[model samples]
Target chain A: MLNVLWPIFIIISIIYAILSGNIENVNKSIFDSVDNAVKFSINLLGMTCLWSGLMEIAVNTNIIRFLNKVLKPIMKKLFPDLEPENKASKDITMNIIANILGLGNAATPLGLKAIEELQKENNHKETLSDNMIMLILLNTASLQIIPTTVLSLRNSLQSDNPTEIIFPVWVATICAALAGITITKILIKKGM
Target chain B: MKIINYVSIVSMPILIFIILMNGVKERKNVFDIFLKGAVEGIEIVFKILPTLVGLFFAIGFLRNSGILDFIINIISPIINIFHVPKEIIPLALIRPISGSASLAIATDIMQQNGVDSFVGKLASVIMGSTETTIYTIAVYSSCVKIKNIRFVLFAALIADIVGMISAIIICNIIFV
Candidate 1:
């Protein structure tokens, strides 16, 4: 949990910095990181708002319903407890679609929307539901078809073949997603 | 490559166009609906802002304190047992922590090793295959105010380990 990991990260880094005599860099990084975080959030804000707006249109026009139908089999299998008519199903489908298209920024807003919907059905409200944990796992082990950022970075670095690693990326990502889902399923089944 | 680039570029615009057209055909007040959702987006961002600031600060301290290199030195011998490249150990470690930090490390790797080198290809595959696990989980869980994430973190990290190891093996078979 973040409650435990956050402090450990800071404590370990501070002690390491002191021993290495790199305390100044750590001090500078604190401020620099805050600044960077704000800038990053602002950048995220625009894209998120844009996607959220577009999502509204998609929902109002039944585009989400169409997408949900297309993704029904997969969603049903992954979230068997939920009804096909659930709002969370639509949000999850849109998030997965955006992710598959490599729309990283767009996917975050939709993913948050899906989590919000899932929270509505959560009885405990504090602890994550099984489906919520599965959603997070899916995001962490992201199944992106094209890694736009990596390809662009490689192109900028003047690689002879900018997209040469796409196939390998697919292989690794599929393996990751499968592994995460399998472990989560087992843990949930064992009442973890 | 060109076709992939083109699809990636046009996909968003095309999606947007389709959504907007659908809204019009449905006779909805498109602008009003958009504003409503955008407002919700603002609230979501505000809720997660503090989490982002804290997570970034911790990641920054970790990355700048020279600890990752120390950790890498300690783990390289163990990692060598699997025949994985030592140069990418830092990347596999950092990939799940911070996106920007991993990007920096990946760029550094490709620059030093040449973009077409075996190490470079492995780094690229790793970058594409993994996500910033802590950040994504923190933002989502915090936004919905979930206190206990349970086994999600454990399972996700397992996924990252599998992904990174697979990247190394796949790169060896395909690139080398």
Candidate 2:
């Protein structure tokens, strides 16, 4: 996806600069960007390391497992059609837990695994089931307690209080999650 | 609510404290374990460097050459109905398709409209509040070999709109 979009951006900028006669400024910006990006990455380095190390501790302390345990029953309730002990449900639960913590990179593999497990139960072989639809809905809803990446960005840009949006982000994502789940349930009940 | 916000803000420090306490309980080398994970985290940052540089260059040139604003002008009237800043139109468009694209755009928005400004805050909220629905559907449905998405796309897009609307309204009330 980036392969296609990146080049288009490059081409558009070059052409637009030529036509608009802003060629000099565009050229300077293109070169200046690497330095800025590196600086931004360095800013990110501290937080990523902090959080990842903390995640290791959380793992070692069995905190992550405890979280998984708490969310597992909610998963079963959400997808009542699936067996209580199903592997897909386990994967889905782990994925959602990771997402709730705003660990997207962590959630992705679990989400993929869940989908792969869902594919196995797909007797239709080519069509989706209601359970799969619900999983997809929840996974893509952006329900999270922390908006980690955004906070990191704000910190990089030197916000007075980087985490100020914490409550607002939480509210926004909760609304998205609720609306997503409600829409999915309504659609499924309508036999879509 | 303010108390809850403070709690969540300090939640990580508290989490680290609990984990270290548990580390001591388990007789593990807490410092060594932390160092190991931190090293891996640093590696993740370096891994992202090349892509970040490339994206930055592209986004920079686009913004500098005035193309982004030109495109924004084209879409401004339509989006004015929702009263979102013209600067964020590109973000709203690509947000559900690509995370990096939207992040690049959000950074651009922040650069243009100072980080604390309403537009910048709105961009941040929107970026963090919604999923890349089309991209996610493409990946997950393909993984499950589901050709017919049926109402999945519809429901997801509706959620995106709802998420976007709530993000705007809430940010306006609080941040603006």
Candidate 3:
């Protein structure tokens, strides 16, 4: 089903791009943006490190433990297969925390760690477990509160009110996260 | 380059110490694993490079071609029904393209209008919350080895609708 639709979608996008005169600009941008891309990457590395360090500090100070205590009942409801003491559960929680803070780059390592832990528990050769699917859905639709990265970009661009988006961003992300989770569960129930 | 090299050099020993404390018995083989990881990272980057370029080109061409304006015009009536500014249509349209590009557009809106203005706040929310469609599709599909994720795409689009609607509702309540 996807195989047929994927090509069609790509073709349509390509036609749109060509019709819209973006192909030429895109060609120019590839070269023109390289320097900017490099600079952005370097700056992002620094930001990621700072955020990761902060997260590490939080963990060491038992902030994570506190979060776990607060989130335990919710986590249990979301992930019944995961024991409270499971390393994967902890990694998943950390990833969610970083994402909520809009620290996506900081969440990558934690997400990878979570995946590694999940793979270890997957003894079966075929099909993802319900918990694994749920984790992926959650990660993909992780609700953000602060949207730090977006605000930073706005500031860099000299916007007067960089933090103004916080309220709307929080609402949108939370709703999207709920919708993604709900749809995933419904699909699973229908045996998709 | 020099600063990056210096940082890497300083960090190497710390990484090694952390790995050693983790009880990795084959401590000497850690270098090999590190190199392997680097290679794998590079491979993944190259694998996605073409798609990334394609996505960027598509977005760029669309913006330049006035397709965005056409889209805005068509969607304006619907958006007006919700009391959202017509300018926000473009940002919403581009949200699924590239995060940075959408941010650029959103920033432009904030600059033109007051950032605290209803439209600016709404655009910011939409930009911050939504995922770039192509990037999400590329990442998740590649991970699960699912060649066809059409259903997932539909599901994601539906999720994006919810996000957009929520952005409006929340902005009206808090920012307006």
Candidate 4:
């Protein structure tokens, strides 16, 4: 997917920049984007290391097992084919937990780890499995409970009631998640 | 707001404490295990560095080139037929593409529309509900070296569209 989309973005951007006489901005954006990407990754490293370490502890201590037990009912619905003891299940559970808590920084590392674990079980090395696609959909739907960053941004902008959108956010997120799961299931059944 | 603040602040520390305590109870060499995991984390980050650079470069061009505004302008008339606020078009379009881009647009919406206004609240809901679909998919798939993500992008985009429409409808009913 990114294979085609990435080049299209650059091509369209160049054409548009040329038409609008903003080629210089596009040139600067190229260099700046690379620099920003590195800086952003560096910013992520600290939290990623911390959560990765903590998750390791959780795994070693059977805490993940406890969590898996706790989340089993819901997990079963989302991942019926997955075995209870699979390492991917543990990583997926932790990723979902981090996302729900609005710890996006933590979620990325955990999610990457989840993908790595899922890859180990994949029969086709290049093609994504149903489970993998579902996991990505779950992340994209983003069922965050608090949306702390949005609230903070609103607060900084001096909103009179910064947290008032929480209910609406929850409603939208649940709908998105359901829609994602339903569509993916339909497509998978149709052999897409 | 205060309750939200309190929860966000306390959740992290409490979670960390619980995990460490559990490790101790299990008689694990916590520091050694942590070091091992951190090393893996570093490797994962390194693996993703190229993907981020590529994705972000595309996003930067698409953002700074005024293409988003152009697209928004083209769509605004059609979207206005549905009574969706014009200000949210940029946000809804950008939300699934780039997190930072959407954040900037959302902040701009709130600044211009008043943070307590209908458009501002709707933007907030949209931001909270949707993820950076392209960025997340790229990073995760690339890390695993998965080239074919059949229907994953399609389904994720549907979710994003549903989330944005839900935000608009829910806000209309509640805010009105």
Candidate 5:
């Protein structure tokens, strides 16, 4: 369904772009902004390394263990299949930590590692287990707390209060996560 | 400037050592892993370059062609009916196309409306919270080999709506 729909959506978007005379503007924007994009990517890569290093420090200093201790009950509820000592649990913790700090570029590798760990624990190879589905859903709706990248962009744009939206961001993301998890649970119950 | 440069240079080796110690491997594998990571990074850049170019062009054309305004106008009545601020419409519309572009728009709104303003904060929150719609759908569907994701697509769209509404309400309640 998506294979057909994706091509159609892309085609429609292209047509829309052409009809709206956006193609020319888009071409200009692309060329004009490529330099900035490259610069931004470099800066982002540096930031990612900084944060990942901080995460590594946290792990080495046993802060992650403390976090895991606090988060254990919640993790149990969210991922019932995985035991507390499992590598999947640790990877999930790391992924969620990276995500909450708005280090999505860093989180991708952790997420992949988590999934691989989960796959190893799975006994059946036929279909995705319940835990895998839940993990994907949760990951898709991971709640960001700091929104570091957005704040950086705001700061770069010279906004007066770059961090002013932090509370709202937290609230909105928490709500989305709750709603997504609820819907996912219902869907799973209904065998969808 | 001299002090800063000296500090950075002095700290560089320590930083590398710390990162190396985080893994179980010795100094040799650190270099190897860093090289591997660099290669992968370049590969990702090459893969996404075309899509980024195309997306930028499309967004640029839409803005210049006045089509964005037209669409915004058409939706203005509904927007007003919902008491949604005019500034948020573009962010909502563009969120599907590109997250970074939507952030740029959101920053502009924040600049114009005052970052503490309800609409500005809401736009920021929305920008921060949601994923790039088309990108997420494309990546996930391709991964699962699911050809027919009409239901999934609709669910994601509905999720975006919910995300938007929740963002506005939460921001208004908390900030305003």
Candidate 6:
């Protein structure tokens, strides 16, 4: 899907840039943002490393297991077909925990691991299942606790109070997550 | 807000302290383990390098080409009904598809409007609350070999819309 969409984005951008007679600005930006983006992602590494390392310790010390113990029932409710003791359920809980902590890049592999496990549960079905859809909804809405990236960006840009948006972000994301899950559940009930 | 503030301030210290205490109890080389995990974390950063490059490249072209303003002008009337600023339409449009683009735009917004301004606050809230919907869908579906996305796209998009609207409301209530 991204394979197709990515090229189209590039093509349309170039064409539009030319048509708008913004060729010079566009040309300048090509060199400008590319290097900056690379540097930006690398700069993200410092924070990600700290979080991921802490999470690694949490996993090693069985804190994550305890979290899974608490979250399993809720997970079972969300994904009725997933067995509480199964690998997929555990991965899902781990993914959710990582996401709630606002571990963006770190959460992707965890989510993909979840999808992989869910695939196994589906007996290798080529099409998406209801649980898969629900999981994706949860991921997209994200319901994060600390929006670290936004805060860091704000701080870098010298916001008087970088973390001021924390409350609003949490409230807004909860609404998004609840609405997303409800919509997915409704769609599932409709057997769509 | 206070709870969030405390959590944001205290969560990291508490987490690290617990990990240290656990490491001591468990009799393991936790520092080495941490370094290893950190290395893996750096690898994850590198893993996203390609996506970042492509996204930034496209965004740079599109944004610099003035296509965004043109599109925003077209959508201004509709969004204005919801009291959304014309400047924010770009952030809302690209946020669900590309985080990097939205980050760039949000920085620009803050740079232009001052971080505490209504539009600046709204952009921050929206970016924080919403996910890269299309990218999430694409990565997950392919990972699980899910050929048909079914209702996933609609659900993600709707969630993004809800997040955007809530960002607007919360920003107005809190920051405006």
Stretch of 10 with least lDDT, candidate 5 chain A? A53-62
Model 4 bad stretches (over 4 Å): none
lDDT of 2 at B54: 76
Choose the strongest candidate by lDDT: 1
Kindly report the docking quality category of candidate 2.
acceptable
Q: What is candidate 2's lDDT per residue for B73-143, written digit by digit as tens? A: 88889889978887778898778765666888899899888888888888889988898887677667655
Per-residue alpha-carbon lDDT of candidate 5 for residues A70-118, written as tens digits (9 for 90 to 100): 8898888888768888877887887776676556766654565566577
lDDT of 2 by residue, A79-182 (tens): 87887567777668767876776667646555766778888888787777888888888878987777877877987998777777777777788788888888
Task: List the per-model TM-score of the A chain.
Answer: 0.95, 0.66, 0.71, 0.93, 0.72, 0.78
Predicted candidate 5 versus true structure: per-residue lDDT over B52-147, tens digit per residue: 554554555556556667788899788888888888898899886666677778878878887667776687788877777665544433333434
Ranking by TM-score: 1, 4, 6, 5, 3, 2
The segments of candidate 5 whose C-alpha lies over 4 angstroms from its true place after superposition are A14-23, A26-69, A83-87, A116-133, A154-161, B1-69, B140-159, B174-176
Fraction of true contacts kept, per model?
0.86, 0.75, 0.23, 0.86, 0.21, 0.76
Docking class of 5: incorrect
Which pairs, if any, clash in model 5?
A1-B147, A1-B148, A2-B147, A22-B61, A26-B57
Please list all clashing residue pairs in model 6, or write none if there are none. Answer: none
lDDT tens per residue, model 6, B84-152: 888888888888877767787889998999887878888889888998898678767865557678889
- For candidate 6, give the lDDT: 0.79
lDDT of 4 by residue, B149-173 (tens): 8889999999999988999999999
The CA lDDT at A132 in model 1 is 92
Docking class of 6: medium
Where is model 3 more than 4 Å wrong at Cα?
A1-26, A29-70, A116-129, A153-164, B1-54, B64-69, B148-152
Q: DockQ score for model 1, please?
A: 0.79
Give one digit per residue, the lDDT tens place, for model 1 in B63-172: 78989778899999999998888888888888888898889999999999999999999999999999999889998998888898888988999999999888988898
TM-score of 3: 0.70
* TM per prediction: 0.96, 0.69, 0.70, 0.96, 0.71, 0.85
Higher-lDDT candidate of 2 and 6? 6
* Cα lDDT listed for each candidate: 0.89, 0.77, 0.63, 0.88, 0.63, 0.79
Q: Write candidate 3's Cα lDDT for A1-192 as tens digits.
A: 334544554455457658765566545654644544444455545545444444444444345677788888988877876899888888788777766655676665556556557767866423455565666666566466556556666667666666656666767888987897788778767866
